[model samples]
Target: MNRKTLVLPAVIGLLAPVLAACGGSDDGGRAGGAITVGTTDSYTASKEAPAPLDPAYAYDAGSWNLLRQTLQTLMTMPRGGGEPVPEAAKECGFTDSGNERYECTLRDGLKFASGDAITATDVKYSIDRVLGIKASTGVSGLLSTVDTIETQGYKKVIFHLRTPDATFPYKLATPVAGIVHPEEYPRDKLRTGFKVDGSGPYTLRAEVKGDTIAKAVFTKNDRYTGQLTPKNNSIELRPFADADAMGAALDKGDIDLMTRTMTPAQVEKLSSATTGDVKLTATPGLEIRYLGFNTEAPVVRDKAVRQAMAQIIDRGQLASTVYGEMAEPLFSLVPANITGHSNAFFNKYGAPSADKARQILSKAGVTTPVRLTLNYTTDHYGSGTKKEFEVLKTQLDRSGLFKVEIKGTKWTDFRADGLDGKYAVYGLGWFPDFPDADNFLAPFLDEGNFLALPYVNSAIRDDLIPQSRREADRLIASDSIEEIQNIVADDVPVLPLWQGKQYVAARDDIQGVEWALDSSSNLQLWELSRGVSG
Candidate 1:
């Protein structure tokens, strides 16, 4: 998911500003205690996201974090991350040898939060509405391969695919495939407002301030008939404007847990501090940051200019100085931890070298001191963004082969400008829709990519991507995946920066802090509970 703004496809929108203290008071106890969770993320009901929580429209992690609590998908990832497993469905699998047809049988006596029965029709309708709406900010692109959905009787649903896509089940595990009641959500338009009517682990009651989601209260849904069982009776999610504000809330006992968008300073303090009751848990993250070039732009459009910039930027210094070593220097579009990952960029560029950058520009017959404008969001991706860009500008300037100007704007305008191709180069972050190499590469390199960049590579997009998706065994797709990375490294449409680590800061008495987030980094609030001594 796009990290900070509305991502066009399966990208996540990161943290935003919202009211901090608006949820229910925390009731202290053991397992069933009401847990208060805090984040800096916010979602607004706008053209980009007409319905902040509608399964068909909400594409940001903040919205998905809440949606996963109230909406059940046909399939879901296991708690610690693995293959897609049956959740609402009793069984699901590819019905054809070509992986073109998928079928699922609904569990008996399934019911929505409103007590309405969840049938195969609801499953078909949920997917159909998502495809029909085709919201630019929605994850409809994830289901583009599906030709049509067919329902048999009241329990069986089948999907006919236009192409052989073995990754379809992983797509189903995402919030984009979340089931919505037919009566609550419309057929062709997004259902607006802050209410949810699905039969997930929780029933939601949210408070909104204008377009900002101030707070959300989740009560355990007694009608939920899924594999997950709630560890707590209730949960209260509060949103803050920044890391400092959220850290203050945690320090003062205003929140039982704090996660998503924790600053490097905050993580360092929590790691070293021995006086406070706070504890920090870090996990290998799928979140990645990169520099996206507008291939049609005047200056960065030149392959030499893009290559020179890539050759000069120092990822090790950037990660250590700016992120306090919380993030790892990334060389490939796919994260290092994910299968089929490769160090293609590192293999080509080697260490950061200005001499090599000058030679590449010289060989391409491009004039020296090429001018470029780099853009980034001011409020998104934490407070270090400005400093990050400042450091980037310094690095490019030091090369003596380029003149770089960095600009900052609010996330809404920044995203709009980037999509409109207003900058020569801009920074973007990705939180995967699913944990796969395809999630990282396909969304950025494919035709009509989420980045809105004019990067077109027929071999990688038309052949390699489809080839990889056809393999039921993802391990067998490594050759195709590696070839795609090499092509990306050569084209230089987007330069990989750093891969971040997921951090959750919670009170020492909080249980299951490590298991609160799923593979795609979506919060599973049901896993959170108070310890016996809490």
Candidate 2:
């Protein structure tokens, strides 16, 4: 899941005098004619602490969104959001077979917000810095295939890959590859403490007020020569306590737009109500909610028990009762509309049946009334989590072959403890870093993956995924995905639940609602504008 939207730090109190000196308006809604966006700081940081702003260190969605605007990558996800297009680079493409070598040319006369000359050396430095720092939670893993970086004169950069990875360019489109003025940013360490010098469409203004860092303000970077043009002159992103507060603020026009914090009920209310005050725009989302099994746990370690649980759960009912129509039943771990998606679980199990579950358990010599604990996060996921878990408990308990216990934790503790193997079977939701079957497969199933679950299926970990990565043709790569899902369905490492739809709510006068969410489901604030009807 994307990190909760970050709230303005307490130091924002200090920006008043500075903003006032600049003749800014009194209301936070309009800061010197800038669009004000409100969201929750829920997913902005790790469970342990507040997020850092350095593009190399920042991992949460909130920082990433802000970074994308303030830091221009070599390639960027366009407004409609399909393939990554040239941003700072004149052009980028692979120069060798198996996608082992990639090359790009820096656009001439490109300059940073600080007026520093942009060079191919800066591009190499930016990428090497990410690889060198190697933040555990950062985007460094996306470029793990990169073996070395080479530069030719002032405009050309080349990447030699240790292994073929077709998704390398897509990685460049992310904030991890955001080029920086090498002189301003240190090569050995992360440049923390809230100062940014980027070549993107926007620039971030942050200052130290007493002991705390003030809210970072984003304004148009007139120096940018990229494809993106800011619709608003400035933007102030602030965080709310919850979705209800955000909705109220939007209704009152305190905020021009709200992204990534609304509940399904809020979407329904905003869509159904004829108040004509707010508009709802839905985007295709690759978000997948699933039940992950820790293979090391005594109770769930048995493949038969996991398969039995997978066979008994009712997804259609969960979608209707818990999620309404906001979600659809997901039969495969890979979301629908993506290549290599198959209804493998649905095909294998057919339907929820206690008889089938019992037969599977009996054949595996597992005794009846198998004891299990199901875990979920109360805060981070959504308001529907409690109800959804209850439904899961009911379905499993009714099977008579299992005794289930439900446990709930706050998101921070849940995230930390889940990775530490605190829960035997826990619920997880995935928001893709990139729009590919690889994003879905790699993080969860790859060896030494972030999932932290000891689910190492040899054929999947060692063979299928690596083979799929080498195949450039998405259609051919999809065959491996089909086989991988079938293996998951048969092994039952994780139970595929439901995939969700994305919705962004804004006032009637807000334009670019259709383009607000990229194809990857990341909220694009640059696409928004006021004084125009959507």
Candidate 3:
């Protein structure tokens, strides 16, 4: 998942001094009208996300935010967050002691929004199509352990894995494993256009504008069979070009709630008593941002150079100056909230010191005034990014040991360029697929990592990751997870920056704001509804 961006304080003038009254009408203890939700995140049909609505191709958080509303997975995490629970399935678990075989039985009378009965055959086809298509940006890597899928009957589906994987159930809980209709979705290609056919709580009807989505309309799919029930009759998801516009819409009652990409200034303003009609809800967030190095690039390829740069970076300053209270300095690949988290970077490098960095570079026989270019996305991670990068440049340039040049590009091109090794160092963010340390470490460190960097360590990719996956109890794998962190700190392939907190700004009458986001920070639109104020 990509990190969301924030707007500057200059845009704060666009918001009304006080938000208007709630827009939806209350009915039978629930919201009777449609709740309009606004977000600044936009999507384009690029290689990163070829088809936003298709379960086989959508991978990023913005796409999955909408997909989760319509595509019901075999298993799903609970509202407040926990282990995977049955959704479309009546029950699911490992059938063998080795954790290689898994089975699931569909809930009786399960039917898609199209009124066709959901069965084991559809489930098998869905998994097969995702693996067969193998889109570069898709989440096919999550299902790499699956050797084959077999359907025993109309209700039962069995999976055989090539290796022991205790985290298989968690993978199934992700939208990547969402079941698709066999006839509607081809087995070897992505479904075209914006239409979606699934058994989830909502049915989607999107309005497309050129390469981006203008708005998406979701109606309660009464035919849906699942663990969740809709709290509102309908929902309208409005995508904005930036956070300033979205905040203005919320203040003017153009949208009932604003989520996903609120700027830091907007959030601070909403917390004041002057904005009486707006409510600011803060939740524990697992999102993290970091700088990734292209190990093959001439300037950053030297281990000493990367280590010296890591020593000079002040994560605390970045967290406080750039993000305010919204983020905290992170020392490990794993966030502090997750199990097996360790302060490996701090333990190795201590506090940021130009003296320490100079000594390391001198010992490595490297000359002073080293030059390098830093790349970041201009439009993807909010407008505060420019300021953040500017602060970073000052931090490095003031050391007098390095000369830094920074460049910003749009997200689509930045991602593509990063993949093609056109950048020496680039900024990236991660939103977990599941709430596990494995999701944090394995994606970037494993062989053929998603970042497309040439860095590799046999000890981490070959030994530690597989050992952790063999244990069903994630707690038992803490030692291996910590060791992985230690190796990363020593290698410096990716430098840890700061971890973020999830904040949602909504109208005072909006209910379920606390339960609307799962552990992974994916928005659940079905959980939102208009409520009567006390």
Candidate 1 stretches with Cα past 4 Å from truth are 1-33
- What is the alpha-carbon lDDT of model 1 when measured against the actual structure? 0.82
Q: Which candidate, 1 or 2, has the higher TM-score?
A: 1
Q: In what order do the candidates fall by lDDT, top score first?
A: 1, 3, 2
Best by TM-score: 3
Between the candidate structures 1 and 2, which one is better when assessed by lDDT?
Answer: 1
Per-prediction tally of clashes: 7, 5, 3
Number of clashes found in candidate 1: 7
Relative to the unseen true structure, what is the C-alpha lDDT of residue 354 in candidate 1, on a scale of 0 to 100?
99
- State the lDDT at 26 in candidate 1: 34
For residues 43-66, what per-residue lDDT tens digits would candidate 2 score against the true structure? 334324333567777655656777
Clashing pairs in 1: 1-11, 1-12, 1-431, 2-11, 2-12, 3-14, 4-14
Q: How much RMSD separates candidate 2 from the native structure?
A: 7.8
lDDT tens readout by residue for model 1, 1-534: 001111112222222212122222233333445789998887667654468788887766778888889999989887767677999999999988999999999999899989999999999999999999987563677888899999999999999998889999989988889899898889998898898989899999988898878989999898999888787788999989998999899989999889988888887777666665666766657889999998998887788888998899999998888998578899999988788999999999999999999999999999989988789988767888888898899999998998889899887667767778888799988888888898898778776567766789989877999999999888899999999999888889999999887778877666666677654678989877676432
Error of 1 at 207 (Å): 0.6
TM accuracy, model 2:
0.87
